[model samples]
Target: MADDSDLPQVVNRPGGATVGEQFRELLEARELIGFLAVRDLKSRYKQTVFGLAWAVLQPLIGAAVFLVLMTRVVGVDTDPVPYLLYVFVGFVAWTYFQASFTSASEVFTRNTDLITKVYFARLASPIAALVPGLVSVVVGLAVLVPMLLAYQRSPGWPIVTLPLWLLALFVATLGPALMASALLVRYRDLRQVVGLGLQTMLFVTPVVYDASGIEGGVRWLYYANPLAGVLAGLRWSTIAAAGPPTEAALSLGVAVVLVAVGMFVFRRFERTFADVI
Candidate 1:
């Protein structure tokens, strides 16, 4: 038998870790993230009878309802991009945002067993929360191109930029998610507040309508939301004829600031999770 002195030593850092340390842990714990992501997928969909089909249907059903409303009741205008495709793309992108937010909020609350018992990369939980719904988003986008062909529409030259827009969507989502997850560990009530905030964000994000439809002076405010730019990019990438992403610079700037602030808040709160959580 090996002597206790010869055993591997695990460094214990209470409170929280530094940024570089956190990054290293996250990199080292990529497998943990994958495992957590799979667990999330199972708990979210597989446990249910319909399984992942529910994931696919939820967005489609919501989009269908909104499509009827936007085209009929409100008579909303989304020129160049067909109203059908516009609503579908917007719903798909928004679904991932909603999922990421909810998942992030529960990162600690859902894993109290692990958080209290073991030492691993706490950061991985929030990052993994962003993954499970991504499959639905990918499926939605893949389905869109075929829909366009069915409708006799062309994706045009803008299709090449689709990857950038998809990347932007994940970028826009990750920071807020991490921040939300950390905050929830201390303030569980924030779950409802954050959920309400997301609902407000959905209406504000031009998902059911176009930014051009808004009044000019206040349109800049709408562009300040990073998801607005991302949503615009998604629309443009898939529709080709859709309007350019307005105020692209301002939205990108806001996204960077959001990421910085979220990281700051998350790091500040993470140190106390094992205690208060």
Candidate 2:
């Protein structure tokens, strides 16, 4: 996987390139993107005792802890739905986001040697950063089916929209991910900030609790966070829970804006990445 013989050496000079052209470089460098993604996946799991098991186990353990705390101690009410099942679905989605985001944020810093020496579209770095997390999310979903059956639950009609939900989540994640990855090229401390921000984001995003649980005007908080609607959509498509939140549209808009800003910011600094790094 470390082999870069086939990797494109095309320099990604920002110059007067429009944002669309710079972003399009991501598509144009498809082979390089795939190569980087595979290299990243190998790098992440290489030489580990448990290897990829860490990906599966990390979310499982997180869900179990949340289940105990939310179910036994706090007694978070999911009603006919078992708290474990409810939380696991949410955990899987969060794991995808957090894992992808953390990796994307560090793409530049971690690939200093490559960026400083080679010539390839840096956008490939962020796009590649996103691929490996899907391994965990897909495995989590496979594990979810049996639990759903044990609970005598199924995904229902909304399951057909699962891919759509995943696409939306991916698009939404691209916002911070691109911004974080691009900014970290210059501000190395941003690595620590991205981790802390995501940690604080979990509680606010409703991963361990249902979005519907929040009532009254305060509910606006849920709609304000982009992850809320994406998570809600994931739950709706996977678990066939209550329909998506009333303000799901608002969250989607927020996500779109984040992506736009992230791209703008990333491009603004793109020309300087190689020299600065």
Candidate 3:
């Protein structure tokens, strides 16, 4: 028999990868990400009779509830944009944020088998969860495209800045996702806390209502919240209206700070993940 030991081995590596090297390695692992993403999609809607319809249906239902509350109960003013569009934009953005956070928190725990056996980057687990949410966000955006066209609303030059806004949103939400996922390995209660906190934040955020609706001390607190910029940008993009510039800037700045801290924390804790998780 030929000496098989001479064959070049493709051993999988894990952490200690520089950010740039991690990204390149991640790109090389695209097939793994795709497989996990498809598995997640299938598992999420698996037993449900509605299947993929759950994607559109869940957000639509959420928007309807918000529309009723904003228009009837609170009587919040929506500028040129219809209440449906206003709520839909916030709901969709928030959905992506919340989904990313919750999914990321359990990444290490859920992928223990793969992590224990595989040679791929540990970052892949959290990154893979993002794929399903990204698909949902794109599908959700497509649903809005027709509505915008029907309304004859022109997004104007302001729409060009969307890429920046999206980057801000990604980091704002992803900070918590990375932080929470890393922490959850040690403290499981963090997951429940994150879930409840996100729910509370939804009411406080300018999602169903405009920022003008907040007043007094509450207004300052809202501006301090990292989600303020993302929510404002979502409204600006879909409604073609500008939010309070100063508050939006502050919010975006805070999000950047949070992301920095989150990155530091995640890196610090990552070494122990294999042991704890």
Quote each prediction's TM-score. Answer: 0.91, 0.90, 0.82
Clashing pairs in 1: 15-271
Question: Tens-digit lDDT track for model 1 on 160-269?
Answer: 88888888888789878878988999998988899789989988888888776666767788889999888888887787655555586677778878878888898898
Per-residue CA lDDT of model 2 for 1-277, tens digit only, reads 5999999655435384666666677678999888888887898789688887887787889899998898788878877668887788888888899889988888778768877788667778898889888877888888889889888988889999988888888888899998998888888877778778988899798889877867888788668788899888888888877789679888889999999999888888877887898
Q: 2 or 3, which is superior by lDDT?
A: 2
Q: What is the C-alpha lDDT of each candidate?
A: 0.82, 0.83, 0.76
lDDT of 3 by residue, 42-84 (tens): 8987878987666677677899997887799988778767888
Among all windows of ten consecutive residues in candidate 2, which has the lowest summed lDDT?
8-17
Q: Rank the candidates by TM-score, best first.
A: 1, 2, 3
Name the runs in model 2 displaced over 4 angstroms: 1-16
Error of 1 at 39 (Å): 2.6
Worst 10 residues of 3 by lDDT: 8-17
Best-performing candidate as measured by lDDT: 2
Better of 1 and 2 by lDDT: 2
Ranking by lDDT: 2, 1, 3
Clashes of each: 1, 0, 0
Candidate 2 global TM-score: 0.90
RMSD of each: 2.7, 5.1, 4.1
